[model samples]
Target: MNRVYILLGANIGDPWQQLAAARLEIEERIGSIELQSSIYESEAWGVTDQPVFLNQVLAVSTAYSAMECLDIALDIERDLGRVRLKKWGSRVIDIDLLYFNEEIINTERLKLPHPYIQERNFTLVPLVEISPQYLHPVLKKINKTLLLESKDTLTVKKHIHEHL
Candidate 1:
């Protein structure tokens, strides 16, 4: 089985519940979930006119291939009513495959370790929370380093006391 990191986020209507539901769907579609990060509230990244988002990172152990994982993620988003009306627009649920083991893959539909995980604090913050020692295959640095060097830390806050 491969260990993959998945980033979950939602900004429209009951963000927490959307995230929790997305997790359940992943377990049902794939297999077991290895680890889950604490939920974090963050401001909008690309389009700043929308509501804040609830975000977290999950580590999953699965036997599925990269494309299989992408398909599962797309299924979850579609099932949760993810509308790609605009770039980084508000949505009901958004599931992104952040990393797939140490694989360096780049296809038309998927990119391992995400193309911009290092630049976004919303992803790296929760990522380092669950896996501080995680090493980036392309950057050759730990997650902690990425979190520290990230320049886009505007309004990222962890909601440790709340539930979806």
Candidate 2:
């Protein structure tokens, strides 16, 4: 089985509920969830005008290939009512493939070890919570180290309420 890390975020239409539903769909369609981080509340990363997003990181094990995992994630996003009106726009669900095992892959459709993992606290914070020692394939740094070195000024707070 290939280990994959996925980031799930939502800012529109009951984000908590949307994440919960997405988790179920992920387990059913993508892979079995091995580890899940607590939900985080963060300011919009790229676009500051949007609503704060609820984000979480999940570690999953699957027999599917990386591209297959991407396809399943997109399907889950669409099934959860995601409408990509704009880049980084508010949505009901956003499922991002963060890492696929320790492999580095760049294709027209997918990129492994998510290109932005090192730059976004919204992604690194929760990721560290669940996999602090996990090493980045390309950066050769642990998740905790990357989070500590992250320059992202955005506020990322751990949500007190449990949604995962």
Candidate 3:
């Protein structure tokens, strides 16, 4: 089985429900989810005028290859109402491939250990939460260290879920 890390983010509609739906779809399409970080809320990364986002990190055990994982991740995003109108645009859901078992891949479609992993608080906060010791394939630094060194000034807060 292949182990992979995925980042989930949403700012449209019922963001909480969107994340829940994403988790369900991931479980059905991908393999079993091994670990998950607590949800976090952060300001919009690139496009500043949009709504804040709810984000989470997941560790999944899958049987698919890196390419297949990307394909499935895109499919999941589309299925969840993601319309890429612009770079860093708001969406109903965004599933990003963060790391694939320490593998480094740079292709036209996907970039493993996501290129922005070390630069964004939204990605780093949850990453440090779940996989503080997980090393970046290219940076050769742990997620905790990456978060510590991140220059991102955005506010990332641990989401307070209202359990009903």
**Winner by lDDT:** 2
* lDDT of candidate 2 over 1-164, digit per residue (tens): 99999999999999999999999999999889999999999999888898899999999999999999999999999988999899988899999999999999999899888999999999999999999999999999999999999999999999988544
Question: Alpha-carbon error at 86 in model 2, in Å?
Answer: 0.4
For 13-122, candidate 3 gives per-residue lDDT tens digits of: 99999999999999999879999999999999989999999999999999999899889989999998889998998899999999999898988998887999999999
lDDT of each: 0.90, 0.94, 0.93
Point out the higher-scoring one by TM-score: 1 or 2.
2
TM-score of each: 0.96, 0.97, 0.97
Residue-level error in angstroms, candidate 2, position 19: 0.1
lDDT of 2: 0.94
Clashing pairs in 1: none
Model 1 residue 89 CA deviation (Å) reads 0.6
Model 1 off-target regions past 4 Å?
Answer: 161-164
Number of clashes found in candidate 2? 0
